[model samples]
Target: MTTLLEPVLSVRQVLTLERVLAGEPEVVAGAGQLDRPVRWVHVAEAADVGVMLSGGEMVLTTGVLLAGDDELQAEYIRSLHRAEAAAVVLGLGRAFPAPPDVMRRAAERCGLPMVVLHRPFPFAELTEEVQSRLVRRKFAAVSLSEAVRTALTGLITADAPLQRLLDEIAQHSGCPVVVTNLAHRVLATAGERPAVDDVLRDWERISRQAGRGEGDGWIRAELGGRGERWGGILLCGYRGDAATGRLLADRAAEALVLHRMLGGGSAHSWEEQSAQSLLTDLIGGVVPARQLLPRARAAGLPVNRRTFVPLVVRDGDPGRLDRILRLLGMPGLVAELTGRSTAVLLSLARDQDAEALAAHFAARLRTETAPGTVVAAADGRIAWDDVPAGLREAQHVAEAVADSAAVLDLPPVVRLRDVHLRGLIRLLRDDPQVQSFAERELHGLLREADEDLLSVLRTYLATGRNKSRTAQLHHVSRPALYRRLEAIRTRLGVDLDDFEQAASVHIALLAHDAQQR
Candidate 1:
């Protein structure tokens, strides 16, 4: 967890104020430490004022009480140092006219900023001005915190998606907001497209170099609860004070954790959602594939000069498939598309064998799932523009074999060639002529609404009209199977022994099933 620093004015900012500038304040020591945050201002003339002070307070005083005591002057600076004061402001008048070397040297050695007022100025006025500004700043910070919290809470109540929450944070921070899992894989991003792309382009390097402490305008807050750290949210290139940035990051983190808990989604589920959105857009083709390349790279996918293999697995568990990919050290994106099909895109180096890797993935899936699981894949595509077509082809192949996987002898990885006629029927299922033909050929059986006969016909047609095999698989006697086949033929008004008619009925049945799936 990143530490949340309270909103405060820095010593440099305080010195630049109108009231402080009227006194012609000059830095006598610790010039490099002007950026130290000043929590408050205190006016004191006591030599032992440090005992009454706390850290982050700018001490204001004159040399009226310590003009003749060299030891006390040096000790005063040391006391403030030990007390962790932000800086010391002294008026050069009365007891001493010039900056005290004893105190300046002491402050320089301790690295405590020391300033001397060349002209007389009222300490009360400077203190009052600084205090009022500090109070207003603190109030504004609190207001900002509540405003962000309220906005995020309202979004959660309205059931807004994770992306919406990220966008809200980005709007408030005015910078790119990135959410990543413990492995540093970017799950989601929200901001200007170009800025987000730039951050993602160098995400790996940046994430690796980011420390637990904030720096370089990057503030990170861990996203987790109940003593478990799963991921983090980063505010990249936030052009605000460190304190303000910390506040924004901490608020955003709290909101994100609450959103996840309320939605009942694990961090891994968010990753899956991210993959689903990306893949859906890619397959939709509304956005050009080139525009999505940076997102792909940011999501930890290898897309440069790689062979892209698109696969659609019917009834495959996405979590299991992802684990298998990781176990095999393969780079891929897995997401559940519409229906029971899940899409997996493999990005293999050009030198690697895409076919062998896809086959191995299918084999592992079968071992983990069912032996008859159909993994429909398209031919390897080298160009990104060809990915949309590849995904569509794979999906068509999966749907083509979805219903017939039980009877058909399919390889572990089924390709378009393996789907053959079924694949062609799936592609044409939406054609008006094909739909009318399927309905006309099967009109009699469709009107009857006899599921028993429909099942018998589907099995018989799927088995290439092999009577004995269909009967055995359906657990029926040959005589009974013949009776069912005759009933189907009579209902459809087709000759039982006609080769061309049976082939036509089989094609119609394939088309009908494809349309239904």
Candidate 2:
């Protein structure tokens, strides 16, 4: 309708589009001089072409939108051109002339893309270009918003994660992709790298050097003006084009907004905060690296590079590790323990990748722990300038794995450790759906409760069958504690004294921490 937002368009965008019509021109606008500062494309059936346009969009016509004469044809073309139509394709064999002189003059006047689709031209070819143009014209933020919408819907409705949506976008570009925050911290990534789970490992060491930057194919993008601020980098491999960068930035902004709304100090910290919260309490940190390494090595991570790092824990936090591995494109499996917590085990193809990721995990753990309390490893020696956030993600993944396993499942998990409990926690925690029942029922409480119910449960568990003690620790009384515990048992349908059932509740609480971290 009415807005302050502007659309971005480029000529090359035409090639990446879907078919607009059956006989549309497979027109290729290589000049890349299409009108910018556009709004959106719409099919207007109104008689006056100019009046119908909201701006942007290459209007497709059989020349029916224009009812003007020879002189008016030029005027009409000029009118559409002035409205900033990126391009105008007039299909031949329609009422409009094959080579309308008026369009030529207007093209010269406004420099808008003007093409006359010859009769019988396959619209499929033309549609791809149109789709490409339309996609590029979009605000990358909007595209990511769409992705977020789809991902969230999929997360709840079809059971998917943001990673799948990101993978889809990366697949579209046919290159490795790094999605970052507004400050350029990578939150998620896809495609091959020197190693698994090393997103900006050791960024504080290298990235601190002003503008050494992360990820290849990501050049410094000037958004124009002070306070213009970088939206973040979008790396493109060989198949990546300039549009991919713009789209990545858009997605970056959208993701930033989503994470910010998730609760953080600012746009930059939102991704980190949300991720920290999501993986924080998973017993064994997330990663399926062991299962994934063979493939990553197959791709080039470990050909002659036998060097490795161990994500040590007695067992692993599969969900936490899964998030990390999912982010890293690493793979592993989760397993459940009969008498212990879940666990996970994975490996990075290279050594430095392991070290860098270890650093990220360490920092996140500091927020909730004492120093040297947690350990995760990464080892890869690639160009340090590559994706710093990836490294950080690797770090956090290591933390999730090491901490989760030690605290909840087993003591001290390792890539090669007998951390079956850690591994089982990871395997069992892999399915957040198990907690979906609590999540839905607890929605009303999360919105209304003055205290965090999850915290209450944890505190109560710590008190060891002593309601008064737990209440005192929580700054509440026995009555309040009892009331809350009853609600939890009722909502969750489990008893604290029933050792097997109570353990599931503990895991659910851990899972909640996993989601937030």
TM-score of each: 0.88, 0.33
Specify the highest-lDDT model's number: 1
Segments of candidate 2 deviating more than 4 angstroms: 1-31, 34-48, 60-71, 91-102, 120-191, 194-517
List, residue by residue over 1-517, the lDDT tens digit for candidate 1.
1125456888999999998999999999999999898888999889999899768999999978888899999999999999999999999888779999999999999999999999999999999999998878778888888999999999999989899999999999999999989987889999998999898878767787654554568888899999999999999999877788889999999988998899847899989988887888888889888888878887888888999999999999999999999999999999999999999999999999999999998888888898778899999999988998899889888989898788888888888889889888888999999999999999888754677888888888788788998998899999999999889988899985788998899899899888887
Error of model 1, residue 436, in angstroms:
3.0
Kindly provide the TM-score of model 1 when superposed on the true structure, using C-alpha atoms: 0.88
Tens digit per residue, CA lDDT, model 2, 5-85: 234444435423434334455443313464243334444434367876766666666666554566666776677766767
| Residue 292 alpha-carbon offset, candidate 2, angstroms | 18
